[model samples]
Target: MKHDEFIRRVSERAHVSAEQADTLGRAVLQTLAERITGGEADDLAAQLPPELQEPLRRPRKAPADPFGLDEFLRRVGERAGVDGELALRGTRAVLHTLRDTLPHKEFEDMVSQLPTEYRELLRVDHDEFVQKVARRAHVSVDQAQTLTRAVLQALAERISGGAAQDLAAQLPPELREPLQRPRDAHAEPIGLEEMLSRVGEGAGVDEDLARRAFRAVLLTVRDAVPRKEFEHVLGQLPKEVAKLL
Candidate 1:
């Protein structure tokens, strides 16, 4: 898709304003340039609109830093002056659209340079999904299982109504019950600290442990869901909560 059409589709799917979508697209593309190698970044940029290619063309003072999807989103959120949630949504929109616009071989080449988890985000299956989380978090399978449930339950609570349903449909039948559980409509939106505290409480762990578990869960889900749908879920959250995702 062209830049304008790409932004329009992202705006429509993410339920953000046109200006917000533009801001998001630019932020994600710029941040992505910092994550991949200079050569791969250039190759990817060549496929983008002229206006969108500037970030990739800018001289890098140092090598691209090693980071995962969470840190990548954090950087994008900072650059975009939006919450982490919006950044996540914007990133998904741009990346997934690029996958559609680029040739199969070209897209595969770009993906090859990214970390394994990055590829997992693009096409996550159930078994691999759990294994990736366990490996990334450095936890046992049982612990990963518990963390995944907590994160998904918290996610279902925070995202929009339609997004919640869509996410439920993506999950296994055994895992669908948590998303279907009734939520308190009058509950207020909480910040990252409060949200993590709740996750810690629910999982009976300390704050530090809760944060680690949340990260594992968030990263896994971010990759498992379709990009646009993930974006919608992020857009519905408070900026603080979104940053964690």
Candidate 2:
């Protein structure tokens, strides 16, 4: 793809301006180049637009710098003059766009060199989260969006404040907002039926739809969060409700 299109895609995905996208994309590519081998970086540079190629090409003579995702994001944030959160979002956007545009084997080869924690950058974003809910619940994206908010709001209310904050940390910004709202220090211990009723009321849907949406949201959350964190969340719930997750 052309440079403009590449930047545009990153901007849209990251919800940033074109100038910001350019800065962030270059930051990520530069950091990525440092992480991968010189030869692999050259291969990656060859596939990208000429404008973006330089960042990847610069470090081709140096040995790969071994680092985890947190360190990678830190470097990207430092380079881009942005905070860690924006750096994470921008990196995901650039990488996701790269995955969409690059040859499958090329993308796979590059990712293969990285550690498992690096792969977590490709985890569900807001769009993917909504799409999963829509697909699983057999609803439209609009309806799924509503259902997602409803269920998550109810979930935030039911779980302890710490658990809710931890869960929010794993999700994309849009989905994270609802869970970040103020709540009690301890879990509310609301029953499954009550949670469903709250979801139904919040979403303006009936009982069946509410149940389906609740299940869909929880299932997505299960995949989105770490097993230990999710277990912590489940521990706050009754057996009947925890089983749904």
Candidate 3:
């Protein structure tokens, strides 16, 4: 989005004047710069309009300040000279806009730096998740749905029951069903190639399509689950399989 349009959206969403919206947008970006790694902030700034990028430009080696939501809002409110409620509204407006505008991986990288509270602020619903995968994989929604279930079912078989359950907990209830299926106690670890084959056979797609869908599903799953939970899932897989994620 253009700088002016971005400001307009924030103003509209927060019910503030354009001047106030500009202040709030800068405040939120500055606070976010503090919260995330300097490198990520730089990358984020690159995608934003030049006028809006100033707040996100920081020292290359600056360490992130460890802060939660309360502290985050406190800093935003103080920096923007707004009340707590307006600060909260403005922060949501800015971040929600960022989510819509940034690439999935770039936004996911920023979200990964925050805690569970921040993740909840940008939670993806089932439809959104499917839509994201479909867009990423260049497939239809129905194809994405079938491919998602196939990938999850194959993943469930490969990982330990506990790990699968943990991952399933983070997914929507509809997506959770595939991960809920019974697993063989002695099932062998599946390699990356085998996984692609299984997903291709199960989803009735070609190998290339399966590979693309598998990556799309895993990347989206990484965004949906907590960083630690996603890491736990990775830990269960062979290095080859884990690298695919």
Query: For model 3, where is the 10-residue window of minimal lDDT?
Result: 181-190
Q: Candidate 1 lDDT, tens digit per residue, 93-141?
A: 6776676567655676766667877754465445556666787678887
Pairs of residues clashing in candidate 1: 121-223
- Model 2, 87: alpha-carbon shift in Å? 19
Q: Each model's TM-score?
A: 0.48, 0.54, 0.69
Q: Candidate 2 overall Cα lDDT vs. reference?
A: 0.87
- Supply the global lDDT for candidate 3: 0.86
* Residue 238 miss distance in model 1 (angstroms): 50
Query: What would the per-residue lDDT of candidate 2 be over residues 1-245, giving only the tens digit for each residue?
Result: 89999999899989999999999999999999999999899999999889988989854567788999989999999999999999999999998788757875687788878998876877778888888799888899999999999999998888888889988988888998878855557778789999999999999999999999999888777656655666797787778975665
lDDT winner among the candidates?
A: 2
lDDT score, candidate 1, position 157 = 68
lDDT of 3 by residue, 203-237 (tens): 99999999999899988887677667887887877
- RMSD per prediction, one decimal? 16.7, 8.5, 4.9
Off by over 4 Å in 3: 1-27, 34-49, 57-115, 181-187, 242-245
Task: Report how far residue 203 has shifted in candidate 1, in Å.
Answer: 47
If both were scored by lDDT, which would come out higher, candidate 2 or candidate 3? 2
